[model samples]
Target: MKYFRANRPLTINEVQKFAPAAFADKASLDVSKNYSFLSTRNLIETLEKKNIVPFAVAQTKSRTDEAKESGRHLIRFRHENHKLEIGEVVPEIVLETSHDAKSSFKFSLGLFRLICENGLVAPCSILDTIRIKHVKADDSDVIDAAFEVLDSSDSAIENILEMKRKVLSIDDRFSFANEATTLRWEKESDCPHLPLEKILAPRRRKESELDLWTTFNVVQENLVRGGLSFYKLNDKGYPIARQSTRAVNSIAKNLELNRNLWTLANKFLNN
Candidate 1:
C-alpha cells in the first residue's frame, strides 16, 4: 500500500517497541489485549513531535467554502532552523464531498519539482512553498499534472535564484548580477574564463527532454576543443566536481562553447 509522503514511515525502534503479539496469554493480563492502548498513545506522541498531527479527529473533518476556491496554495513543513520550508513546487487544494455529504476529501496537492540542470547550485536554487500529495489511483497521471504545474511557475525558480544571491552577498563575496540571476566571486574565481552572465539565464522553457548523457558527450567534446582542463585538483580530491560542474563550466567558458551545447541541445529540445 502507498503511504502519504507527508507521513513518513515509523522508525525501526518505534516498530520494535510497539509491535503486537500474535496470541493472547491465558493466566495474567494480556499485554497483547491492550495493544491499541499502548500503540495509540505512542503514535500520537510521535506525530506531535514531527508536527504531523492529524488535521482532524477520526470521522471529524472540516469542509469550508474557502477550501473549494482553489488555484495555488503553499504547504509548509516546519524545519530544523525554526523555519518553515514552503515547497518550490506549488499545489492546488481540492475539496470533494461524498454523495451523502457525510465525508469530505481534503489534501494539499502539487507537482514534484524535478528539475534537471547542469549545475547543483542551479537545481538547488529552488525555494518556496512545496506541497506533498499522494497519488490516489493513477500515479503516472498525478505525476504528469505535477510537471504541468511546475512548468507553469516561472516565479518559483526566480525566487530560488534570488535567495542564492542574498546568501552569496552575506559571505562578503562580490556578486555579479544579470537580470534575476547572480554568481559569487569564489565560483567565478575558479573558472575565470566562464561567461557568468548567460549561463544562469533562466531557460525560455522550463521542461525539456534532453538526454543528459548526450549532453555530457557534447560538453566533453567542447571542453576538449576549448583547451580548459576538464579535470581540476582539490585538497584531497581528483575531479570531485563531477559532470554537472563540467557541463556548467563548458557552457559558461565561452560564448562559442554555449553555442555548441545549444546547437546540440536543440536536437533533444526539438524531439
Candidate 2:
C-alpha cells in the first residue's frame, strides 16, 4: 500500500522497514553529477525537533533488490505538541521525494479523517509548498513548508463545512460514484461491471447520511481500499469469472488518485 500508518511517531527501524530508500545515502544513477542526495530521514528528524512527527511512510516496490534501494518515498506528518483538536478531521502534510530522479521533493496538504480512519491528500495547497529543485533544498525548507500548512486551520475547516452542508440527491450521488470509477479504474477499463450501489454503500452509521462529504468519503474509501466485487468479461461480452479489486499500492498512484478525487469533490463546490 502507499502508506504504512502508525498511531505514534515511528522509529528509524520502522521507517526503513517500510521505506528504506528514505535513508539512501546517494542519488540514483544517471542523474546529473550535481544532483545531491537528500536524506528523508534527516528531514524527518529535523521536523521531529520542531514537534512534527512522521506518522506514515512508504516507498515504491521493486522487482530487483538493487532497484529497491533507490525507490521514491512519501512520508505523512502531524504536529504532536501543537495539534489542533479538530474533532473528526485533522490536517496533515504529506511530502514525496525520490533518489531516482523521477520526481522532486514535493510537499502537499493531507487530512486525517478519524471518522473513517483514512488520511486524505487535499488537492489545494492549504499550506503552500516549495517548488525548487531538490538538489539545492535543505532541511529548513521542509520545515518552512510544514509551518505554512499548519497555519491554515480556517481554510481546512471551511472546506469540510462546504462539503457537509451540500446534500446530494440519489442521481447526484450515483454520478459522483460513477465519475470516481472512471478515476480509479480508468476510462478504458471494464469498471462498468462494478455497480454504483456497491460503491455508494456506507461502511458505518455516520456515513449513511446523504451529505456530499459522506458520499465522497464512502466512494473514496471503497475505491482506494478495494474489497468490492466484480467480474471480467469473455470474448462475447459475457461474465467470465468473479474477481475482487485490489487496494492502491503505489505511492505515486495513491497521491495522484487522491488528488483527482479531491478535485472531483470540488466540482460540487461551484455547482
Candidate 3:
C-alpha cells in the first residue's frame, strides 16, 4: 500500500516549471509576488515552526498529463500517549484543486490510530476547514488555519478517548451501520437493504472491538474504501461475490461521511 505517493518536495521554481500555466500571465506574477499564493515553501516554513515536517509531497497530474490538479503533502506528527488515550496524529497537505474549471484551495486534517494506523479525516463539525479562493489567497489565513488545527489536537484526542469508553451494544452497532449506509448512498432508494450482519461485518478480526471508536472506524473504512463484498450479476449473467476495491471516493464523500459519523458518535455519548 503506497501511502505517500510523492516522496520529495518540489521547490516553488520547480512547481512553476512543472505547471507553467498556473504561474503564467501578469495576474499570476502579482499573486506570486504578494505571497498570496500558498507555495510549498510557505507550507514548509509554517509547519516547521511547530516542529511538524512533511514526510512526502506528491504532485498529482491530470489523466492526460497536460495539467496538474493538486499536490498532496503527507506529514506525520509525533504520536502522543496519555494514560487515557494513545493515537497517531497526521495532517494532510493544503492544495488547490480544479473544480468546475476553477481553482479552489483548501486543506484537511486527519488522524491515524497507533493501534491500527487507520487514517481518518477529522469531521468538519469538530474542526473547521480553511478555504481560500485563488484570487484572494492570504498567507496569514493559511498559517492561522494550520495553527488552529494543531491547537485543537487536545480536544480531538479527548473525544477519541470518550468514544473508546462508550461500548456499542449489538443493537447499537446495527443502528450505526444502517445510518452509515444512509450516509454512504446519495439516494435512499439506491441503498442496499441488506441485514446489518452483512453491512457491519468487520474487514479484519482486529476491527471487531465493540467500542464506538472501533466500530466507527470499521464502518468508515468500509464506506470510504470498499471492503465487504456482495454477490452481483456480471456480464455473463452469473452471480459472483467479488471483493471490493480499495479505491477511495471523492473528497466531498470523504468529508461528508466523516462528519456524519462524528455526529452520530456525539449523539451516542450524549444519550
What TM-score would every model get versus the actual structure? 0.20, 0.90, 0.70
Clashing pairs in 2: none
Q: In terms of TM-score, how similar is model 2 to the real structure? A: 0.90
Query: In candidate 2, residue 156 scores what lDDT?
Result: 69
Q: Write the per-residue lDDT of candidate 1 for residues 89-147, one digit (tens) a residue.
A: 32221111111212211222222222321211112122222222321322233333333
lDDT of 2 by residue, 1-271 (tens): 5678866777778888998888887777768877766667777778888888888898877776656777778888887654434337877778888887777778778888755668788866344444436677766675676667666756867888999999999989999998898999885655648879999998887679998888888888898898888877887889989988889877777888888888888797657
Please state the error at residue 47 of candidate 1 in Å: 5.7
How many clashes does each candidate structure show, in the order listed?
6, 0, 0
User: Best by lDDT, which number?
Assistant: 2
The full ranking of all candidates by lDDT, starting with the best, is 2, 3, 1
Runs with alpha carbons beyond 4 Å of true place in candidate 1:
1-188, 207-271
Top-TM-score candidate index: 2
Candidate 2 off by > 4 Å? 64-66, 81-87, 125-130, 190-192
Which is superior by lDDT, 1 or 2? 2
In candidate 1, how many clashes are counted? 6
Can you give the lDDT of residue 137 in candidate 1? 28
